[model samples]
Target: MQKKVNWGILGLGQIAHKFVADLKLIPNATLHAVASTSGERAQNFAAQYDAVHYYGSYEEMMKCPDIDVVYIASRHPRHHENTLLCLKHKIPVLCEKPFAMNGVEVEEMIAASKSNQTFLMEALWTRFLPTTKKVLELIDDDVIGEITGVKADFGFKAKFDESGRLYNQNEGGGALLDIGIYPIFLALLLLGKPEEIKAIASIGKTNVDETCHMLFKYSNNRIANLHASILNETATEAFIYGTKGVIRINSRFHESTSVTLLLNDKEPKDIFFEFLGFGYRYEAEAVMEYLSKDVIEHPLMPHSFSVDLMELLDRVRKEAGIFYPTYDRV
Candidate 1:
């Protein structure tokens, strides 16, 4: 039998709860430890998740032995620091996305991973989803002929709260970095880096982009139109256009379980996938597999990819004028 991979999670936020629940779905993955700034919250989270250990402070958690990897589920601004802490202790890390506030921090994180010889991956869960695999397969097989354009959007109505993470500039709040990343990820995956990016955003009272619209023009004449918003609810679907037809990712495309294929002079077909948990298990499983192989990075979501993604985000922020004073170095 394969040895189980012991997991540690930093931060006790909502995303952390969802991630731990998915960890249960992987047979070889076990929740060994959890840590939070609040001692009571850490203890409570540990109890709820049945973690073997819990630490009130992140620094203390780093000292725990036999933790195969640590998931940095902290807020956007903390990702760089949290990841560096794990790498400093030679602990592998799977950090939540928008990997860091900007490209410079991402580069530093990559450098740390290289210097420490430890595994590191940006937890862009959508990249590992079954639906994504199918979409890629279809594109590769020319189910949709030579791709020409892509259009995707993700949005939700968020109540304005000046102090909440979603609207607070200090917390890295903004639709572009929060929900907008989904559309951006899809475009980058399908279209590569845009040669020229044209973007504009609606900056809210809290100094964060409430809505962001991006147009990416590629050298090969391919184009991508992407949008992200926290002010209104959108279809949240993704459409990949090609010379022959289009592949439509169903609503809430980021976590979508189904996709529809529309071919020229053919019928529209819907593809569906069934899975346990909230779809985070796939990335966790991938990390464990890479760790077993003694690899330092995930091929599907490599450090280079994270670097490129962050750099692209920096460009978009520059164009949109979205700045987080505490974290923005670009």
Candidate 2:
């Protein structure tokens, strides 16, 4: 029998809860430990998830000898620090996206990973979903023909709170990093890096982008119109247009379970996928499989991909004039 992969989660936030719930769906994976700045929260989370260990501080959790990998679910601003800590201990890591504050931080994390010879990957769950796989398969099979353009948006009205993570610049709060990355990821995944990027944003009272709009142009006239907002609820859908047809990822495209194919002069067909938990299991499974093979990086979500993604995000921020002084300073 194969040994169970022991998982350690570094942050006990809302996303960690959801990820732990999905982690339970993997047969060979076990919640070995959980850590949080608050001892009470860490204890509560460990108890709730039946984890073997819990630590009040992230540094304390790293002392554990049995953690096969640590999932860094901390806020965007702390991703670089958390990932570097894990790499220093030579522990494998699955850090949540945007990966880090910018391209520089991402490159630093990758350097640590390489120097330590530790496994590292960005936890971009959408990349491993069935819907995403199906979309890529269809495009490769010419179901969507030659891709011409892509349009995607993700937005929700967030409650205004000056000190909240969503509104605090020090916490890396902004629509672009919070929810905007979904649309940007879709564009990057489908169309590669843009040749030119034009962006604009509405900076709210808290001095963060409440709403951001981006237009990307690629070679051969391929373009992508992407938008993200915390001011109002938008359709939250993605469309990939091609010469022969178009493919529409259902609402909430980032975690969407279905996609509709619309061929020219043909009937629209809907495709659905069923999965256990909140669809995070796929990415977890991918990580475990790579670990079993002693691989350092995920083939699908490679280090170069994260670097390019962060660089593209930095470009967009430059064009939109969105800056996080705390982490952006050289």
Candidate 3:
């Protein structure tokens, strides 16, 4: 018999909406409850999604007997605490990306998960997307022989709203955590942890990086260039350049729909995949599969990998002189 996992959503934001929509597309998942700081807001979100239960506080939802897992789609600042709360209830958690403010916080969450013996994963949905899977297959097969270099960029001209999360120093806001993570993740996937990391950024008046460029040098003589910006828009595409061929991912590479491979003398080949609506289902499915197998973390997006990624981000911030309020306690 198949077991269905009931979910309790900790925050009802745009990403949470997408997660709920994707959950409806999966067979073994159910939207059991939702919690928000306000009862009216929780009720409204519940009514829109037809969720069975709603709570004004996360503590109430975590204590609910129906919820088998808790999905933390709250702001990046709250991921660590929300994850700990779920672990306290012995419920598994799938936390949103930029897992926490820094590596120290991530270590704490990981330690808590270990102590509770619960399943926990970063919601880096790109790793589980079908298109990204195919790209990995090509890389593993040496279709793009000995990746010489990789280039990726994610940027958009987000208006400067002082009150917005992107510009606020208190919310762990900045181009780095808000949009830079995608390009950084792409580079890390192609070339593990870089031997040398150097970065330059345009610091805004608020002290947060508004535009950033990063260079990664790998031990195997591979190089990667990545960029992200909030002051202007870029292609948001990615290219994996190797000796024999190159793989070009479409715009919004993080949630890519297809990729093109260019060979030495042959024409480009386009490969595409149909994704479940909004694409969060893949990661959600990964959580279910890992839990059913009694695994504490996902192999594809392991906890150690997540920690390394956070450390890299921490280094970048240190170099760029961008500090958040959360860093003090982190």
Of models 2 and 3, which has the larger lDDT?
A: 2
Please, what is the TM-score per model? Answer: 0.99, 0.99, 0.97
Q: Candidate 1 lDDT, tens digit per residue, 137-223?
A: 999999899999999999999999887899999999989989898899999899889999999999999999999999999987999
| Colliding residue pairs in candidate 1 | none
lDDT, candidate 2, residue 236? 100
The CA lDDT of each predicted structure is 0.94, 0.94, 0.89
Clashing pairs in 2: none
Candidates arranged by TM-score, highest first: 1, 2, 3
lDDT at 94, model 3: 93
lDDT (Cα, tens digit) per residue for candidate 3, span 1-330? 679989889988888998899999988898999999889989999999989999999999977887878899999899988999998778989999999999889999999889999989999999999988999999999998988989999999998899888898888888999888988888888788988888988989887889889998998788889899999989999999999999999988999999999988989999989977989999999898888887779999999989988988988887777789657453
Off by over 4 Å in 2: none
Q: What is the lDDT, from 0 to 100, of the residue 265 in candidate 2? A: 99
> Residue 66 deviation, candidate 3, in Å?
2.3
Q: Quickly count the clashes in candidate 3.
A: 0
Off by over 4 Å in 1: none
Candidate 1: Cα lDDT at 30: 94
**lDDT (0-100) at residue 44 of candidate 3?**
96
